[model samples]
Target chain A: MEIADDSKNSKRVVFVTVGTTLFDALVRAVDTQEVRQELYAKGYTHLLIQIGRGSYIPARSTSDNGSVAVEYFTFSSSIAESLRSASLVISHAGSGSIFETLRLRKPLIVVVNEDLMDNHQEELAEELAERKHLFCAHPRTLHQTIASMNLDSLLPYPAGDAKPVSKLINKFLGFPED
Target chain B: MMRENQWLTSMAESNGIAVIVVTVLTLILVRLLYVLNRCGKSLRPTTVKPLSTLIVLGSGGHTAEMINLLLELQKDRFMPRYYVAAATDNMSLQKARTFESSSSSEKGTPAQYMQIYRSREVGQSYLTSVGTTLIAIAHALWLMIKIRPEVILCNGPGTCIPLCAIAFMFKVLGIRWSSIFYVESIARVKRLSLSGLLLYKLGIADQLYVQWPQLQRKYPRSIYVGCLM
Candidate 1:
């Protein structure tokens, strides 16, 4: 489906949050001039990126006017607010970020940082994707995935039940079902 | 004769007061033991009035695990769930709303969410942590007295330390209203986190659960329930 009218300026904002950890590579990839032009064409009028503790700052380009205004922040106190306003979210594969984005029922694309110990984030991302809750992309293929994403075909995230955990709690609470 | 009579009367009055005090103390002691016994009875399979459970929600991973646990348990079985988190940790509070929003749609009472002062920020100085810990303890005590939940549940977190301490205190005093349960976070694979270690060493929690098999084997007391999240 067509995301935006070619004649009209798109007002949809895309929020990319890296959580509290550093994700400089994702920031750098999204910050490039080529990526900006493609995102603007895809009906995203504004791009808000939370870089966290990342070292690389997205260079502010003066020539890019009304098409897509790029903005970046080191951290944000009101991520919930940003998530609420955002049309789409691209996040690092942290459980906290993944669950929150899913809870909001927002269309999310999670990119896993392979550098982390234990590779837990990748595990979480794969599980969430398998459940059809979100799409998972590796940092290497992030830009390509984002560029080719067909919003209309995006599947609805299933809000998985906590039956197993609840059962355990009930057993511990001594109210196990007969 | 008059002075001797007065002295005897005064001694009798003092003794009378002592006897009354002793009687009251003995009755209180008996009641305390009974309460403790009843709290212990909760471990056995019996019909309880859908216990009031207070879950300590730590930020990030801790909150996720606890939320997952809450989802599995029957909503009706645990009536009037209470959530406590650090005052600064708004994210946990927001995440907890998933349970509240789902539970609120149902017929009965709504869940209560309370934020206590954080004992310390990450990378904070020891002296600062000490100062804040005192404040957190006072807040915890008030919350414990107010909620008086039948069960106190939490995954490992620094904020839970004060609340668990209060629960342990109540248990010791034979208040026995809240039974503490500590579930170690999923992040801890090799060993217990600082909060888990403290809870285990202090013998504060009545029941402890670990996500990994190794933790259960090493700790002995911790029940290995596998992964929650």
Candidate 2:
């Protein structure tokens, strides 16, 4: 598990978990320490990092190039629990991760996996974008989306209402009401 | 007396036009009813055995949704213990385990979970695809004999093929059968995929639960259930 130094001090932290798959393209696209520093300079302590499965370390650190505190990690159950507990979660559009985040009612920012053969994640991101419950950022629009993100304005599903989907399923299976 | 005569003439003309319009409308309604009745008769319900055990076959996000639905149903009078045949080792199983554990903590009934036999390791070969399907068929048959579910509710694609084939074999062996295919959401514009084609070929499904009203034309025996989660 890789922990960011800034995460310890930041008031408003952005936690990310990207799995290790030997694919560095996704991590490289949004691994911006400069943007994190910019946000920190604006009095917004932003800790942007990749931690968990499919993460790879690039040769040169983004911070060394005058970027902010961005970190990376491999898979760990404890780290995942911490990511879930964060104020906001930024992650790839993997269904398992996204569903877990949604179940917790945490504000989410999903960056789609475009390099994959199927554009399934892209489709899912677009659908969620229409619902206005999540923030979607592509490589082209990451800077703008990050700048515009209003943490206070985020409205996740009410805690108890997370099971509406499960209830809907019950009705479909012709389960008699209790 | 002359004014009275003109009034009668106007009333007679209006009545004649009304009769003609009603006749035309009745003819159209009768024709429409005939077509609908023909369709209804063609989709006659085949007798299916009562399903004691249900096997849901899917992978990925759709599978997660399906499992959640199944777990919810297990709480009620309809407790159909399920067997999941996943195409890949997706997160659906993990999510399912979490859901089951959470539910078990609340109540006490452990949600039953089982994995179907797959012929080959993940991403082995195209040749293994056929073998995996055969294994799926054998497993389904063994389960059907052991538990004997009358209806198999298919979410989509991969799992449906083997299950439906086994169900058809069961039907030939004098066991009654039925199937329900649940469509989650309808696309604004309909585009048919290879899986959709396979669904049509199965020809054993008795009812299709379509989420969108516009998709009614696609399935012969469709019931509009709005969005099915």
Candidate 3:
């Protein structure tokens, strides 16, 4: 297969990191032909995925220019770098991923794995979405949600004040508050 | 008759030694308490200098919650901070790095990070847990002595137990001046986690805080501080 010059040099990259836990559902959803075509149509030149310990390996798809566009692995030591270069981030609703993405002020779509036992990610995702920081979807709705997502509506991540924590720390340290 | 006489003589000598040992132990205990009291007085809230704090960052959700809590702390007040992680938990270390990098970039001061051995993971066997816990105690002791933090903070995790135990022992021995502050994780809305139960039941923590009012009713001493994270 010959690679297309347009895809080879295209700038838009999507990063999806599912953290260290096995999130096969998210991987399978993202790997469907429909989702891949939608992403390609939207000008996503590259899709870098960190699938964790998930068993389902995404099949490599070659463009007309034979450039392998969608790349995935079990894990990476360079997740931070990937996050920096991404135009959009789709991630599990893990707090580490959420906070890091927010810190970088990236357009984020969080898909919570409801299959997890006693997962509080749903609560966090709902709260963050309500605050307009990011758009969230369950694993079942991830593909549809991403396909229809409007990047323009996302609110930039907000900075947090130290007031609440400061009060707690002061009290713990036995310092009387002014 | 000769055996009876020897037994009486042996008992008398052992009794004398026991009396001497008790007297000496009591005297040492009194002296230790006096010295500790003096040291505690020096740690009054009026100290102008900033404090060195030690915080335990457990894996996964615990790490995220602790980082959130640390973000709210007045960075200027917590000098030379230390964050502890378990040896096998690379994910926690990575999460902690975000805090270190963000703080250093923003304020030019980076926290000291250390990883110690974990007593046991949830599914590990009881026999291995015992062996690893002993090793964890030694590591915890060495780190605690090296840091000698004025305040030690942790949420609930098995790793924190050994470290807190060592800190509590040092307090009893009057060899260190540090206060243990335990904040129950927000996830534990009903009952305390295993670590929390141990620390609270043993009265090891100087301050115990619960994240919800429901838990406060269960543990009388645990102050409900709402949600810190």
Candidate 4:
């Protein structure tokens, strides 16, 4: 409810992004007392949520103002800025959000939106989880995941190179390599 | 006898038209096969200069994947890049433009942005989409002719279909051969998107790449390029 100007930037921020789609279930799960307390217990001082077209606005926890500060907004022009400052990211299972966080080499937990039928997000999550690129969880199991999450486990996603792909293009076009 | 004669004449005319149609269709198929095989050989193009590259960007996710993939491209080699996105898609062209401007310090050639009509908008009536589809195809062909880029790079996007198809036609017509490179979206782990399927099945894309190994196994024709994103 009340802002502490001096302790703002000093907080260890955990950013949750839903990308350009709505996932109120994720927001609701994160907004609960259990999830906030668990994050606070784990030394996370701030919970920043980019709800992004979702109807369920997360309520700011006035009780935990000095402990774990909660913030939510609908959208931002560029998410990279938010992502850059985040110590950890809990994101919806959109590929754009997944890859963006992975590229940044942040500790990530991807929440699969099971409401969407025949989603390939499940497949991607399974694959990445097996590879230890990111942790995967459902909205129902999110608090449990956060309570037991080990930030040291995730491997940084290797940086992608377009040169190899471009070489294939050049070779297919029969252009001499420059 | 007059009625019988008129009926016979009509039948004969129909048969003649059928024969002409069959012949034309066969000729086109044969030419298509020939061009496809020749392109497989990766024949040296006529120009030795830097390739005029055409990059197709789709809505949101596809555009992000494309920008990520293009980040390390030998930008100098793929000079004079032309970016095409669906007109209804607002941010993709802007993303491409931002990318171009950010990397302007080096030998980055001129980058052009063009937005063509989407083949069909979401929730659009199917009957009206036919007209829009035709317009989109025409616009794609016109864009193809105008840019005439030696290489076309598109990730999973509906807009990529018409552009790649028209580029394949360019090869068939013995105009400039635009080598089409299609990358399946990383999200497609189990199944290829419609655009990827068409490009792969129709032999339109010279190199159809799938990010997931499972997908590559399912579609054997697709080359596996692990995780472009």
On TM-score, the candidate that comes out on top is 4
Output the number of the DockQ-best candidate.
4
- Listed per candidate, the RMSD to the true structure in angstroms reads 9.1, 15.6, 7.4, 4.8
Q: For residues B66-140, could you state the per-residue lDDT of candidate 3 as single tens digits?
A: 777777776667777888999988878777777778666567575788999999874577677899999999999
User: Can you write out model 1's per-residue Cα lDDT over B1-229, one digit (the tens) per residue?
Assistant: 9999999999999999999999988977776566544542346675467888888998787888887877666667676789899898888988888667865666656588899998877557777789889998898889989887777889977888988887766765767557777888765766787788888776676677787677788888676876665
Number of the candidate with higher lDDT, 3 or 4: 4
- Residue-pair clashes per candidate: 3, 11, 7, 0
Worst 10 residues of 2 chain B by lDDT: B40-49
**Residue A141 alpha-carbon offset, candidate 3, angstroms:** 7.6
Question: Candidate 4 docking: what grade?
Answer: medium
lDDT of 1 at A59: 69
Q: Any runs in candidate 2 off by more than 4 Å, and if so which?
A: A1-9, A19-23, A33-55, A58-67, A78-80, A148-178, B1-51, B57-60, B74-76, B87-112, B117-145, B153-157, B176-178, B181-197, B200-229
lDDT of 2 by residue, B113-183 (tens): 55565544423565667777787778867756665554465565455556656665555444643334444
Q: A90, model 2: CA deviation in Å?
A: 2.0
TM per candidate: 0.61, 0.63, 0.65, 0.85
Candidate with more favorable, higher lDDT: 2 or 3: 3
Name the weakest run of 10 consecutive residues (lDDT summed) in model 2 chain A.
A157-166
Tens digit per residue, CA lDDT, model 2, A68-122 = 4455555555756656556667777765566667666677778776666534456
TM-score of predicted model 2?
0.63
Rank ordering of all candidates by DockQ, starting from the highest:
4, 1, 3, 2
lDDT of 3 by residue, A4-92 (tens): 23445567677989987778888887887666666777677678888899889988654544232788888888899999888778899
